[model samples]
Target: MLRTDEILSTIQMLHAEHLDVRTVTMGVNIQDCASADVEAMCRKLRHKLTSRASRLVETCDRVGGKYGLKVTNKRLAISPVAHLLSGHDLNAAVAVAKTLDQAAAEVRVDLIGGFSALVHKGISSGDKVVIDALPAVLSQTQRLCASVNAASRRAGINMDAVRLLGEQIKAIAEATADRQGFGAAKLVVFANIPEDNPFMAGAYLGDGEPEVVINVGVSGPGVVSSALKRRLELEPNLTLGELAEEIKLTAFRVTRAGELIGREVATELGIPFGIVDLSLAPTPEIGDSVGEILQLLGLDAIGAPGSTAAVALLNDAVKKGGAFASSSVGGLSGAFIPVSEDAALADAATRGHLTLEKLEAMTSVCSVGLDMIAIPGDTPAETIAAIMADELAIGVINNKTTAVRLIPVPGKKAGDRVDFGGLFGSAPVMPVRNPGASSRFVRFGGRIPAPIQSLSN
Candidate 1:
């Protein structure tokens, strides 16, 4: 049983901090909708989404209104579309993506994830269909998002899939060149992608999850930064240990607030509540930035020498706090440094303070890797694959969830600004240091063997 007073106490702290649930994603298993006939499959898919997610927005609003905690985005995640795409053609893949878009629009969700393929070990026929259709599907759809898992801790990295995705990603970008490669923004490449993440461009109903569930994404970069600042004002000479404690406590309270609302919304919809992802996901808003938190931690610049250590500390502290707050804490529960989505981080990129290499190093210790970064449009596909290989190598070796969401902005050069607007924000394109130097390396494509660490038994 939940105590309203205790819950209200949690909500009070969130209200004061001006914190809100970043997303409330309903995960639905749609594999049962698969059919040999493409038309029938799409029909079933649309009906299933509409039926399952029709009341998601309404329920979230009512539940949030009860505590004055706004649910910023309502969305959905479905079982990987690849499983249903088997025996289907590339055109069928586009049709399915279009159906997903229509369903999302009908249900009032911001975006829907799971037009995805899990090719960590090998690419199946269905996976090929999803990859091949990216150019057309992404260009035509509005609210559809896609992801490809090309590497994993247990299976090592699939260089073949990574290389293929590099080529396909560029095609998707060119297909949407009018929008500054925005289509690529909707697709992410991952190593060890989470099953129940409520965030976009990667969330999906992975195997072993419930048929229907509600997952929550609650990010409070502003709240965490404010808490640290207050602590600093009181004890101007506080040690890093003490400041980390402040961040941990702030994360605990924030997790509690997010989980309570998630459970209430789940109950209203008569579905099981899933995990609360307590990532410090930043926004373009001035005060809401993970980089600013780094600055508060005494870094004069965002990407200074000790930036990786600072990110390591923040990620560890955030996870510890969320874990202590709820046993249901799951997903990527740490600090995210998506460049364009974070105002301070974007400024640092523009001023040459943050480079792609520095971002990769930080991602080794941060929650997600090299997210929302814009690169020169003319970058070679081999270079893109090499960049992904580096980032995924971190996740594969460290056994953490790391992903890449790079936007190859067409006709844009290094240091050129791109305004994606809204939560997507904007960033000056960061130069890829060695454009085609790694072609020989990526061309020798094969599975990079799993580390000895995978023999955990």
Candidate 2:
């Protein structure tokens, strides 16, 4: 703990590799804010959120500045809005969403998550309200994010919920077509969704969590890549096993740094520190890509034969490092490969080096599934459901977290470019090999039984 060289090395790496905490997310349990009356419920939501998170931004900045670190985003996640919307109608759902946007804006947070529904087994009335209102909710709100859990190991997959979400995603895109389907980017469909995820579109305060908590997302694909590159420069013949060890060490430092900052912020805010999500979340920025790390790991192309294995190695090393660094490592603590958000992956997709099928295979190993990938607007709802069914099947069978964040850009076709700009980035729409071929399969809609793994005692 007293090694000056280690401290200096950490400092150097922070600046040199563009390392910074990705997000400081404050989770507030708002289940107490529920009411049958729409206006009263919205009022409670506003008061609860504002009172709980008013100082989140200020605290993140002050704490980060103390350590010469930058907290890229200060965000908020509430308990599932579905609970608050129970016994409410679609209009009430819209009202709750608007209230969230307003409250988050007033508190000056970047995004507000937890507009979510857990429909893994079946959709409750509240879940239905949230689902039905998504097209309007997403189209009209800027800072609001939503998630729907349609699959889980214990409950199998809710094909009904999946089919609804597939259709609604199209509706959401057409509702916001003027913005090139950017609204769909704010939604994530999940299997075995995490309660404390600090990442956007999927974050929410799950049941049994504390009343209020602070979670941090430390994303360092760039940092990991830089360390690998430096090591390779010195010894060009190091084996993949050796490289994974290096990744673990680098992840250890990153996780420690993240937890340090997150705990400090939590202490200042008078709430418990939740976890450090050590996911290697990437951006469109050059040098800050997960795909670049894959390239550095001797993959000539991202979606080649060895891509899945490389991702598995990276994801495993990261989890091991984070687990060793902190007992508080939760959320999706692995390497992310969101296509549009990672420039290298996006370029690989544009160049035909990556395809939907390849991306699905990699998600079997990576942290998240089919993230930020755009497809033709004309893609069938049944096909979208099939895509989700396949990814969720992976999670349900393996008992891990996997999600889909696909955008079907209106009026766009496969191979056409759709620029969402900013961190949402852009991608050339990838073709769904057989658009409506899966209609019958997805149409035979019933729960896909959970694997025998669910019975493990």
Candidate 3:
């Protein structure tokens, strides 16, 4: 099973393309950390997390250095704390979030997800607690992130949960207004959310997953963009299909590198390896932008006329390449178009080249939806629900995962700038027309039926 030349070639391709493993997320099921007594539960939660994830970030860095690859974030995901704190009050639920944040800091991980609730059908007592605590928990916590799954292909959309989350989002923004509504940055509302996703603001240790597992998120926007550039220069008349094939091949190599590193790290830590999430997650950096990749695909700008088709091609090629690379590939492994997180996207939004509607259109073909988008503080909650409903409808109809992380900058208007700093970046608050008039539609609280695709045997 040894091939020296093949290994060397893989390394060369990685180095040349500027590809690297984006994150090594360890999912630690903390359902067992729950107890009838609050103090006992906190103790169990701390002990389990510290024991399982004590060396996660450190080991990831060590492994990355050893392979001459960079591991950008080492993260942890736990079971939905809402379910664990069902009998507890909102204060108790917030305490659980605090424990998660402290544990994450002790482990030195960048972020800890799973302050979550899955209320696609109906809300539970724990779900209410978590939802109510979101304003405080998000504003108070440092590294903890939260996600709420309000819709699924099988269960349809929960209009009640959607409406509530819309209000909760506003509250969260108001609670952290002084910090640019940074609390909203840590929360995401999703449709058809993936369980084993290694990405933040959404990743959660699903009930079906093992006690502890390693999930890798591999990113390669730069790699694919560079490959396309070289191919375009070499064959000026190459078809779009040929260009996509080249991108797929490059993604295959990148996925291979991720799988190899993930397995090694899992084996060394004596834990089960979950899957390789081959999402082309971009950063605020120049060359690493997914919007830049779209520009390379001949688009005049990121949100131009042919932008949706270009995204469709890029997402399809990335999935095909990742699927070919490893049988263990899972999670939302497609192109992410977060406006604030990608420099080019932020520029486009600031220059009025990209709008909220165009971003929604692109999310239909891409992985995540309306990510890191900032809007006016006065944008009505009903408008947020309408936005979430539109994206979730796309996910339900297509049977894909889509999510929203909208930041409503307090006291800020469309032209105002909100800086979240670091990986979240900064963006001009985009305008949303007719921010009212959706409340009546949202108030008819019932589930949106699943699409025909869910009838599969």
Candidate 4:
């Protein structure tokens, strides 16, 4: 039970800080909707999603309004579409994506995920079809987001899938050249991807998830930043250790708020409540930034020498607090540093303080990797794959979840600006170092075996 004073304090946070439920995603498993007949499958999928998610937005709004808190985005995540696309052609794969887009529109959700494939070991014929159709499917759809799991601790890295995705990303960028490769922004490639994540571009209903569940994403980078500021004002002599504790305690409160809101909405919808993902997901707004939190933690810039250490500390503390606060905590519940989505991180990139190398290093300790980063138009596909391979390697070896959402902006060179607007935000195209140098390495398309540590069982 939440104390009256705690509720009041949470209300204060809503007004004083950029505190809000980032997303309430309904994961609807549609594996049962699969059919060899493409038309039949599409019909079943459309009906299922629409019927299941029909009341999602209304319920979220009603619950949030009751508590005087806003649910920023209402979303949906389905079981991997590729799994349902078995025995289907590329054309059928694309049609399924369009169907998903239509369902999301009818339900009025912010985004719909699970146009995904798990190819950590190898790509299936169905997965191959989905991958091939991504350029057109992503360019044609607005609400549909896609993800591919190309690496995992047990299966290591599927360089074949990585190679294919690199080419597909390039094709998707070209397909959406009118929008400066905005299509790539809707796609993520992952290593050890989580099934229960409520965030877009990476969210998917994992095979083990319930037929229907509601996962809540809680974001409070601004709240965390503001708390640190107040604490420093009160105790100017506090050390880093003490500051970490403060961040942890604040995260606990944030997680609790999310859990309370999530359970209420789930109960109202008659759906089982999922986990609270306490990720310090930032926004383009000036104050609501994970980068700002880093600055408050004594970094002059986000890509500075001590940046990785700062991120490691922040991630550890967030996970610890979230775990303690909610036994049902799941998903990638840590700080996200998407370059374009966070204004400070974008500025850091423009200032040359946040280079690709530095960002990659930061991903080793952060929630996700290489997110929403735009590189020069001419950057080679092999370079993009190499970047993904490096990030995935970290996750595979460390047994963590990491992902890449790199957009090679079409017709844009290094230092050129491109605006995706809305939640997608904008960023200057950063140059890929030694652009074509990794072609030979990436061309070795095969599997990289799992490390010995994967034998933990």
Candidate 5:
């Protein structure tokens, strides 16, 4: 259906700008793997995951090679273990987590999410157990990822659940202190968590999803940045609207490429295609970064004065383009600004050009909130809670999905480096000036009432 010129442009963009499908995530519901006997349940869970995902990574890689596209990650997301752990003890939950970890390793997937709980309203017994087991489970396992939905637009923010999660996050941090609380890197606390996300540590198979499905996350920050740079070079007086249109057209091509790859993978794997997550996920690579896109928008540095506006424009344009390209687009399909993952952002943090406050401001328009950020090791639990509360408040008020994945590197002071290695690049431990000052405010814990707009429905 593409014209000759458009097709050539797409090929040029892909080759020059590092455009590629970011992730091919398989969602597998594990509720049916539950059983009265803990051992039986764990065995079933392990077997099912191993059988289903054994060829996932291989298939994705093979397909990527055929199209000359790089599939960055192959992952699995299962039903929240909390619902399946109802009436089971903490030991049982850990056992299930071990099964998940083993299965992930056996199948050679990078990460497996859904050590999760949906407690936006209140915590059930199962939710409490899964939360309590997090510190031990995450510290003990390697590939399993966890998330908790502590707030939602319709149900309001559960301050009690948020408080508990804050404490749990601290415990997880302390437990993995040797790795600078890198265990917490595998966990996310969210507001209005999406069910079909293919990225982690936020991806989880929600209760309403089917038995098995394939969800794709397509990334093209480099592609967008290249387009913006070209436009600016040609027309210095290009309006913001014109810049956005350029991004939209580039995003449209990227989304189409992802849809083609994802559907092909799904068909080969014999699973229903879920959605395409048209998120501009970044990496530590030089040209493949969301922060570079911000820089291309004329900011000398990523967190400068105009950074948030640039991110807002980029996010909106990417969403608009993806929506036009595919009716099945879902997840946090916008620009992601994970601190450690983007080299420019990391450099800005090291140079003191970016701060936690600026990152928080940028999250208002970005896909994920406060992602892969490392703070001072001695940061108080109350401050972490306040940070999360602020981010969740934004999502609740705006009726969008937002999450916090803060890493409190134990024993590391401000400006210290915490190296996570691989795609979770190293981050300088940023200072948190006022740590425990928010304790009194957080102690008066109850539901933060829903925003006025939420009541209209």
Candidate 6:
């Protein structure tokens, strides 16, 4: 039970600080909706999604209002669409995607995830079909989000799938050229992707999850930063280790608030409460930026030296606090440094202070990898594959989740600005150092064997 003082503190956070539940995602298993006939499968899928998620948005709003908390997004994550595409072709995949879009619209959810394929080791026939259909599937749909897990700790990296996704990302860019290749922004290429993440475009109902579950994502970089600023103002002599402890305490309160909301939602929906994702997911809004937290940690700029260590400190403190607050903590529960989504990070990139190399280094310690980054449109497919390989290798070796959401804006060159608008934000197209140099390396398509750590029993 929260003390009276604690309750008032939370109220202050809600009203003043940018502290609110980021997303309340409900995962719905759709494997039972599959059928051998394409039309039958689509019909079943549509019915299942509609029946399951019809009340999601309403319930989220109702419960959030009950607590005076705003649930920014109500989302749905279904089982991997590749499983539903068994014995299907590209046409079937597109049809299924359209069905998903229609169902999501009818249910009034913000985004519908799980138009995804998990081919970490090898691509199944269905996985290949989904990959081939992505350019059309993503371009033609608004609310549909997709992901492809091309690497894992045990199975290592699937260079073949990586190469395919890189090629298709370019195709997706061309298909949505009028929208500045915004379709690519809806797709993520992941390594060691978690099964229970509440965030998109990487969320899916993994095989081990329940038939239906509610997961909450709590994001408050601003709240964290404010707490740190207040502490420094009050006690300027505090050491870095003491400052980290303060962060943990603030995160504990945030996670408790999120869990309270999630459990209430789950109970109302008659589903199991899954987990609370304690990611410090930032936005384009000022003061609500992960980069600002790094600045508070004394970094001259986000990409300056010691930035990686600073991020590691913040990520670790957040995780420790969330874990202690909730035993069910899961998902990517750390700092997310999506470039365009965070105003400070976007500015850093625009000013050339944060290069792709520095961002990659930072991802080694952050929650996600190379997120919301806009690159030159003409960047080579091979080069894109190489980028994925390098980032995924970090996750594979470290045994953690990492993903890439690279948007190659069509017709835009380095230093040009591409505006995606809304929470997607805008960014200057950063240059890729070696445009076509990785062609041969990425073409050697095979698995990069798992690191020695995988041998642990």
TM-score of candidate 1 versus the correct structure, residues matched by position: 0.97
Comparing candidate 2 with candidate 5, which one achieves the higher TM-score? 2
lDDT of 3 by residue, 1-457 (tens): 9699977666766676668888899999888888878878888899999999987877888888898888888999998998788889977887788888999999888899999999988899999899999999999999999999999988999998999999999999999998988899999899988999999988998878988999999998888888788888999899899989998998898898899889988988999999999999998877888999899889877788999999999999999999999999998999999999999999999989899999989999989999999999999998888889988888887889999999989999998888888888888999998889887998887888766764665
In model 2, the clashing pairs are none
* Best of the candidates, lDDT: 1
- Candidate 6 wrong stretches, greater than 4 Å: 1-4, 454-457
After TM-score superposition, the amount by which residue 85's alpha carbon in candidate 5 deviates from its true location, in angstroms, is 1.0
**TM-score of model 5 vs. true structure:** 0.96
Model 3: lowest-lDDT 10 consecutive positions: 448-457
When superposed on Cα atoms, how far off is each prediction in RMSD? 2.4, 1.5, 2.1, 1.8, 1.8, 1.6
Model 5: per-residue lDDT, tens digit, 75-111? 9999899988999999998899999999999999989
lDDT of each: 0.93, 0.93, 0.90, 0.93, 0.91, 0.92
lDDT string for model 6 (1-457, tens) is 6799877878878877899999999999999988889899989988988998878889989988998988999899998999988789889999999999999999988898999999999999889889999999999999999999999999999999999999999999999999999999999999998889999888888889999999999999989998999899998888889989999998998998899999999999899999999999998999899999988899877799999999999999999999999999999999999998999999999888899999999999989999989999999999999999999998998888999999988999999998899988878999999799999999999999888964655
Deviation in angstroms for 327 in model 3?
A: 0.4
Model 1 alpha-carbon miss at residue 187, Å: 0.7
Candidate 5 regions with alpha-carbon error over 4 angstroms: 1-8, 454-457
Q: TM-score for model 2?
A: 0.98
Candidate 4 clash pair list: none
TM-score for all models, in order of appearance: 0.97, 0.98, 0.96, 0.98, 0.96, 0.98
* Candidate 2 wrong stretches, greater than 4 Å: 1-4, 454-457
The order by descending TM-score is 2, 6, 4, 1, 5, 3
